[model samples]
Target: MGQPIFYGSVHVLFYRNDEVLLLKRKNTGFMDGMWSVVAGRIDGAEEVVSAAIREAREEAGVDIDPSGIDVVGVMHRKNTSSEWIDFYLKVKSWKGDIVNKEPHKCEELRWFPLGDLPETVIPYVKSALARNHDRIWFESFGW
Candidate 1:
């Protein structure tokens, strides 16, 4: 077999009262123009938590203390392919405003309430939020 690709992405769901930070991806790669939380691939030889913190800073220009962010669960997404995703939930905290650093990868940034989320949100993120109500931690959730 040829070289295989195994992706490890970390996502953190941040809630401010009712609304949450979401990014509208630009017309680029997968799920372009869709809304999703802070996400980025885990680098080789790097810790998973560091990836989440780095993604938050790089994607949204936010500084998150790695230890403060709680790992809600790990969802093994298998939509078109299989990949491991580490899910974190930061209920009440975070500094700096949400800014779109990667213009090529994102177009707009907005905060939507939990009760009234946009239809463009990625299916996996939607499922993550809904299922998070039960405090489900460390389990596989489909995309």
Candidate 2:
């Protein structure tokens, strides 16, 4: 086989009432203790849209209404591993209370205003949030 087919991931940016949802990673993994949006790898035969919805439900314990989330453009990121991130904008109201179910993967989950976000946010995610509604990428990291 040639170069391995890169796997894509779906990321959801759920913003409401001037606050955005972020989770602090706790377990041992890449970017642990960092704050990030609900993201998950897209499984084979699974569409990115469904992945986004599933991730939000599983990670944040939020049931997203299908009619609400909108699929945004894809983001191509080339680091140690190259990937095409399928971006989705979920602005609709969701049911169920927010809970940090996966403490191993996430320590705490909370919403913060855009202007006063925590410093532990994943750098790439921070850039993405800053460029919400705009396709222009403002930053890049080799690693």
Candidate 3:
């Protein structure tokens, strides 16, 4: 074999007080009708932090400073068809009003209490959020 390849993506947990922002995916073919955070695939040659900031802006219409975000956890996820490495970043503060920037791909954006997330959240996303960020740095899903 030459090498192994995995898709890389970033997830942003925008926190406000006791809540975290979630967007209901709509037309996205992968996980339509499920709730997820601001997220996207890393562009070629882009730094992970830069990808996080770009995703936040593209999905939620928010601007996040690199210094204001924390890489809370990472997940190595694999299913029947593909594998992905996902970085979960936490942001307690950001600029601009949060809106559904991609109305065609996302249905609506809402905030849910960190302690009580909705049942519709994406599986791996829910797993990442349930982790004790201070203690765990990585997790694996779907074997």
lDDT of each residue in 19-56, candidate 2, tens digit only: 99998877756788789888878888887667777888
CA deviation > 4 Å runs, candidate 3: 1-3
| Per-model TM-score on C-alpha atoms | 0.84, 0.84, 0.93
lDDT, candidate 1, 19-131, per-residue tens = 88888877667898789887877899888778777888888888877666767767777656655655556534667877888887888878898899999899878777766
Q: Count backbone overlaps in model 2.
A: 0
The order by descending TM-score is: 3, 2, 1
- Sorted on lDDT, highest at the top, how do the candidates line up? 3, 1, 2
Global CA lDDT computed for model 3: 0.89
Per-residue accuracy of model 3 over 26-51 as CA lDDT, tens digit each: 87788999999899999999999899
Best by lDDT: 3
Q: Which parts of model 1 are misplaced by more than 4 Å? A: 1-5, 133-143
Candidate 2 lands at a TM-score of: 0.84
Q: In order, what is each prediction's RMSD in angstroms?
A: 2.8, 2.8, 1.5
